[model samples]
Target chain A: METSSPRPRAERARQVADVLRQRITAGAFDDGPLPDEHTLGTQLGATRNAVREALGLLRAEGLVERRQGVGTLVVHPKYGHGLDRLVGLAEALDGYGDVVNEVRSVGIVTPPPATAERLGLVPGAPAVHLERLRRLGGVPLSLDTTYLTADIGVPLLDHDLAGRDLFALIEETSGRRLGRADVVVHAVTAGPDTAALLDVAPGTAVFALDRLTHLDDGRPVDAETLHIRADRLTLRATLHRGPA
Target chain B: METSSPRPRAERARQVADVLRQRITAGAFDDGPLPDEHTLGTQLGATRNAVREALGLLRAEGLVERRQGVGTLVVHPKYGHGLDRLVGLAEALDGYGDVVNEVRSVGIVTPPPATAERLGLVPGAPAVHLERLRRLGGVPLSLDTTYLTADIGVPLLDHDLAGRDLFALIEETSGRRLGRADVVVHAVTAGPDTAALLDVAPGTAVFALDRLTHLDDGRPVDAETLHIRADRLTLRATLHRGPA
Candidate 1:
């Protein structure tokens, strides 16, 4: 719906695109191709021009594609990853497909200063360093690099990392449950190495998550940095207002 | 810290950059310029070559800059916004600076289909629409477009929107305590118009937040789309792990 005052065409297009994007992601068009621009315009009570512009925006986002004769089609579907829960990639994407971890590297090494601090490791102490290329349904989703305290990390080196989540392995090995995590989420342009791993063009926007996970006793044990493909994952949260 | 096996130089640089970026954002360099590459390399237990490349990476991210005569300097400080809490921009950046809202437009209008559905308005029902350019310390931070149910939104026009957050005004006007919000966060390239408003170049990566806030009784009242400058804000959260 248009505002009372005249707004820029681009803004109007964005509004329409927002609505269409939500509907597309919600599987409104799973049965068949999307309606024509004229139909979408009438359905959303937007101008035909705005609807066309909105479709163009969606096309650029790689969510939908315009075919010469097949009409508009939903090209990619993004999976929602809940940010309120401290879950592993496999647990988070449960029911989507089997999340396979390709363990690129795993060894005992010196962690960076910040990682060492987060994991509460003593200076000069060795920690387990693990690098994984995580995939869902055979498509790369994230590149995860993790540092763990030596006590628990050393045991994980012998576990089946590809078939199970690290959280599970940590608990099984140390008998300590994961309690919580402090996470920082930001957008970063994909570098050449990351882009190659995630199979995206260099400079594409991706979600960078830096997290420090703690044991149930409040001892930090895991520090991870994850570069997730933005087009494939959406971070979701339900937040409550605290006292002012 | 280097792994036991040799890794790519670029990957090593990224690891160093991550640690340095965290330290920079934590105000580790407030007293002076960053240490020389050799000193930093020793501090982080990385090679001088990797430290040099790390500084280069930070320079590209606009987090740090290297001067010809002077040393590296932290260019921009990012404000961390708690994603676990439902608060206005002003509240999120309380200690940073005064968050001023520049109301670009406010009026009653027909909302898009999804907006109307989210707000639970009947077909053809009117809702209050607001567009605000939010700034921190006189610099643009976010572009907020909001839609509210008519019952709570109609009276907001008379409130001091520019000086106060909408959450405060909504509660004051509707006499309804706000409860929770559903938020979705992702990254998008800024369009030409949005880039102009946020004083960034076109195609700059920005955080796009879509939120639907509800009243204490679970009635959704406010729906918003926020385009936040990525360099100026970082989203933080403390997440708990649920039972397996």
Candidate 2:
């Protein structure tokens, strides 16, 4: 579709975004507010239009906090969940130790057909279900609902989760070591019920992650569906490229 | 974020959602409307209340689209771009060749400072800028704004892009083979200008991708920022895991 080129405004914004991103990362304005539009434009020899555009990009990247009356302030560090390893919510939210886990429920129930098939169970088989809410500094961060087949889940239900480490509990009860896991990350709007739990409006975009873990012998041990607040969390990963 | 454990209604909804998802994916109602609430409840042995809750989940996933009076119909196939490769938009949308390219503008301009730095150019150096709109079946699909430095970008300016393949033109004109690219994918809301361009309402969620491509010898060749409608496309990737 060949038509007229885009307006120069966007190009200018890209330039601003690039420069500001570096300055922020290099700690030029460490823990400080960004200069006003006039000052910043003068300092960078960029038009105020460009600087404003750049700030929008930075805010979209979750790099700065912009308030109407308050100046543009650098937001405090946020949690970064790495995609390379199998990390739990507690481990992912490490820098912020002011975290708590509230186990909402635990019981045995008929497994969903798809999940039952994944766990190599009969269609009507019962599975152990666990629902837990993870909070950071008393604010909801994520809600995790996990399904485990009875062989391992039954033992897990009998164990106390005062510590809230489901993996450890599963390993101890099932006597199986987690070998590897497959994680699928995608986005979904919060349903009414999820919105109430996560303290967000219904239809707000959220990170929906599904994880399937396996035992050393290649047995599926556990499956978890985790819904995380997108605003408070950013998942990071490096996609390596090699010669074709 | 301690609050009520969420209503039992949520739990019931999830159970319904889970069962219905399997049915849909299994082609139980392929290309057809889902059974009405009463019919569905009777078939799955679930309460009508739960069936209604489940439909909401399906609607959000774009699996089954709802109409005011007609009925809920299954959506057609969707595109899934893999993150593992550096695929041009034209190549990614090859299955639908009816897509037209509208080049917004083409010219030499002052390189945005940060982009200049990344491209190894001195500050204020001129770069080639190309803005384009991509439409599929006469419907706007994405907006692409690309930045190319002069040394390589100049020669390609004279080449014809009637085929809508800029990468090929660049390769032929610059005499350089494409190597690898690093792409970052994230979500952002469509601001006023962007919304108008893509024909979407303001604040609609869109997928933003930033790609930096390099030459065979590791020289940066092009940098592009592409905005795509999320509801129209989903990026798929298989994340492999091993011990760190």
Candidate 3:
């Protein structure tokens, strides 16, 4: 007579679990009420203890669940969201009312290192700067900073910036209508400056969107960075399998 | 006597900026060397003082740059990476040699309410649980936890999990092939559990990818959450012009 080697308690449990895992994944065992411990043990030709141990292993893997009185059951599948689209946050909250943007500060200053390179500017050219704290119904959401060339709108800083739309103001004042833009998004935590501006807890998680707008001729003209709360915003993107 | 109202310093700069912005965005001013302050001021018939103030505003907005002793320049547009794709990190690093995955534990348990709903799992069922820390070149890159249906893989715990591909193993063991998946990406600070597993500093900024995979038949198979180093990884995605 052939005999299988005696297995340790843990090993026995593992052996039984392997068999059960195969059956469930193979679709032989659909997601529904499972056989009782005795029947499963007898069917697999293993002890009830071994069957129980195997079931324990499955539970931890987020695969199965066991109710107090009810038998074990199976779970269906799920889907997740994408992050590539250049959608606007304002658009994301289109239905939500009471959206208000609080103007933090609006002034002119020099460009930072990365910003200067992106804007195709001289190391020392004059530019117009605007900063604001965006809020929805008094709840702070994001901190935005925008830059424009001085030659384009020399008197831009004197506008009623707190109430006016920037792109519209640029069109009216400079005669340069708003066009398309390119954007970059990244995961980031709130730095001291952003934390203070957004009034969030220090070291909280945040999402950052960096964008550069261009004219119809494709010349880069403006740059803006929007820093926002991560939890409050849900970034979604959909991709097509076909050609770009 | 015809007299024009004297413009404030801020207002004068803004006006100068509007003309320059219009010209630049219209491509009349390519992202190239600018005319000298005296020349530009004379051509615009504006005082150099007002021009300089306007330039200052643009610099702060990151639209233009003032290199040390160099002239102003325009910046290039930046691109953003989205988290909505259903790509696997292990697959992302396939160019590297064999990776070592240390299986921390496996057990049966119930998922949190949110996770349960996301996975489409019943309130009570057997969930297979697995925790692993992923490493690259001996350095920890991510820590992940996955949950699946126990009934799909009864003897799952005893499988040769170490160094085994979960997807491959599932196909071979359960005959369930994955067709598509949905995912969510977010920025977060390392918590205690994540810090300990990935060996990262607590409160360090990290990107989190939460995902759910489905079979070709549209059955949800597994749900996973991955915590990765934010600075070390750059997420990328491509988008076309138009709605999905």
DockQ of each: 0.56, 0.25, 0.11
lDDT of 3 at B30: 52
- Please list the C-alpha lDDT of all candidates, in the order they appear: 0.83, 0.67, 0.57
lDDT of 1 by residue, B1-244 (tens): 3334345888888878778876775678866789999999988989999999888766756567777888998766778889888888887778878999888888989888777987899988999889899998888999998999989988888889898999988888888789999998877666666778888767566787889999989999999889888777889999988786
Model 1 CA deviation exceeding 4 Å by range: A1-7, A30-32, A242-244, B1-7, B30-32
Off by over 4 Å in 3: A1-84, A107-110, A121-128, A148-189, A212-222, A238-244, B1-84, B94-99, B107-116, B150-180, B238-244
Question: For residues B59-79, could you state the per-residue lDDT of candidate 3 as single tens digits?
Answer: 533335677676876432211
Residue-by-residue lDDT tens digits, candidate 3, A1-244: 1122233565446445545543453344455667889988766667899788778755533234687787865432111123454334454455664446666555556654335555787776656666667776566777776777665545666676555556556666776655556655555555445666677665666656556766545666677766766544534443221211
Alpha carbon lDDT of residue A74, candidate 2?
67
Q: Order the candidate numbers by TM-score, best to worst.
A: 1, 2, 3
- Which lDDT tens digits does candidate 1 get at residues A1-244? 3335345788888778777876775678866789998989988989999999888876766567788888999865778889888888888888989999988888988887767877888787899999898998788999998989999899888899888999988989998789999998877667677778899777666787888899988999898889888778889899997676
- Determine which window of 10 residues in candidate 1 chain A has minimal summed lDDT: A1-10
Better of 1 and 2 by lDDT: 1
Candidate that would win on DockQ: 1
Better of 1 and 3 by TM-score: 1
Model 1: fraction of the reference interface contacts it also forms: 0.60
